[model samples]
Target: MYSFLQVLWFVLIAVLWTGYLTLEGFGLGSGMLLRRVARTDKERGAISKAIGPHWDGNEVWLLTAGGATFAAFPEWYATMFSGMYLALALILIALIVRICAIEWRKMVNSTKWRNVWDWAHTVSSWLVPLLFGVAFANLVQGMAIEVVDPSNPMTGVGPENVDLSVHVHNLTGGFFSLLTPFTLLGGVMLTAIFLSHGSLFLAMKLTDEMRERATKMATNTSIVSTGLTAIWALWAQFAFGGSQPLAWIPLAIAAILLIVSTAMTLTGRVRSAFFASFLGIAAAVAFIFTVMAPNVMKSSIHPAYSLTLWDASSSYATLSIMTVVAIILVPIVLAYTVWAYYVFRARISVEDVTPSGLLPYKIRAGENFLTAN
Candidate 1:
């Protein structure tokens, strides 16, 4: 049996991932829709401003989730990172580019510069979700993993003084092995859901023409996402969820919520639609964690080789220390996040977007740097 701390940390890690994806989903979706919903530069600026105050803050959850996984389950982290090195590198690079684009888009005066960064932002935003979906789908479906003795020279372990009784589960598949049809569908499903989520958020946070456009987009995307989610969730549950039959509860809840969100969007209930999508995403993530219980990493080579929660967890003393620290910090972080959102809760429009770029800031001969226009 897994220790109490092990189970607690597993649940906590799942919560962290759920928080990151649900919070960042709308921002990423908004970035992808940057060129789709906004026609003019000012309109695009308005959309950017809608998510600007919260996007960076939202990333903290992802960082925390990664850290938690590393500390709580070092072995699982090692295997996963080593296995998905190339894919993770691509994701990191895309995220860096997206961050740069968001921060520097208005720093230059040239329209060409802004346009290039805008496209970069959109592409990176789309890539992150796609890769994440693929990664998570692979986790649910199992991977090419095998247990190897450390004494085996061919397995990269030195024979000298090695413990033959202990074995490590390592991923053997190359990067291309991650691109099965189901995983690809998972990527597309995530993209569609985020698009709908972002459109709904924009509908609630924008005014006038932008609001109407966002509403229309949300309705269409939500319908598409709902359909895709139904297929994906059902496939995941039916094919790989025999071990955890009760996981169907959250899966069913997620599907029903998506349907309701679509209906709400169609009926002009923008705020309700956004909330439903948020809950739907959360439920879907819950379902994923539920299905993945008992085993942190499922090995396709053999059932006995799979890494269970106890096999992957940290020492009991380390978990105890981490638990204490988390109890003190998690609530504070959550409170601050809620307050920040509340402070920035205002609708925006094209008129609200002021002239951006360096050309808009000119200094007269007598004006100091601080007083410049």
Candidate 2:
């Protein structure tokens, strides 16, 4: 039962992660595509329409993941939240900027105001996932947290023990640090993969010239993203010593599908490409997660401070209660979320931004979005 629950919790975590990646992946991706699409007002409006109505709601998956982590893995929540506060703060700042771009868009009409929001949204959207990619790369690489009693305050132990009074052993990346060029480069690759994934989404949700433009963009984005992912996966395994020789097989499959999906999208298989890109990204993330399994954070400071699945899991009773609640509530949440998406699945158009639309009458439409296209 304990193992079963652990697996369930992991699955839930994966679902939550996938949800955020798919939803916010495109928000960031769509925003990243803005520079390319911004040649004209119609193109810009189409991008806006592509991402509108759903960006903020998409973020709730992150919130839900955090809440689940607290409930199911309190030890992890405490240790990482406390230890990684600095990185988390910057991540939070990016989140705030991303949210503000959506919220503040309605407050102005001038080109300057809209441009400011555009830049904010674009940059924040790009950085958010890059941060995750970096963090995930570091996580899979492992850490240096000590396995000693947590109650004992002073605990940064290394084999060649250097005891700095501070609990956090390192702030900046080290030469031997897991945040190596390969890892950071993987983050960059992830950013591109998500951008391509998002372009497919835009292809599905938009129409007329914009849809055609997105479909064209999706083809190129797929080519580039797949190429980069291929290069990164090879580098990660062979050169960087991340070889799970079999691991590359699934990623290879995902890469093939990415190419095929692009072909499909360009050939008027919009729905196929949309769904295929979803599969492609899911497969890719799964590949990464599989490679990174059993570690959420690694100690750059020293090997002893490393946090792993065994040390970081919550006590049995706590996990039990959380499991019970999740088993009961998660299905309901999934049901409702699916229903809501289906109900709102229609592609948002320029018309929806006008008065009398579902979101326009709301109290908090994005301020930049209020400006005419």
Best by lDDT: 1
Task: Evaluate candidate 2 by giving its C-alpha RMSD to the native, one decimal.
Answer: 5.7
lDDT of 2: 0.68
Worst 10 residues of 2 by lDDT: 354-363
**lDDT of each model, Cα atoms only?**
0.87, 0.68
- Per-residue alpha-carbon lDDT of candidate 2 for residues 1-373, written as tens digits (9 for 90 to 100): 7766765676677778888887678778888877675565445655765666677667878898998877776666776676567667778999898778766655554455656777888898788778787766665555445543234545434445533233333323332443567668777887988888777887777666666777788877877787887787666556423635566776777777777777786687878977777777776766665655455455545545555455556667877888778789878877866776787678755454532222333334445544524
- Misplaced by over 4 Å in model 2 are 40-43, 144-155, 158-178, 237-253, 266-268, 299-305, 349-352, 355-373
TM-score of each: 0.93, 0.80
In the range 216-309, model 1's lDDT, one tens digit per residue, is 9998899899999999989999988899998999998998899999999889898998999999999999998888888888876677767788
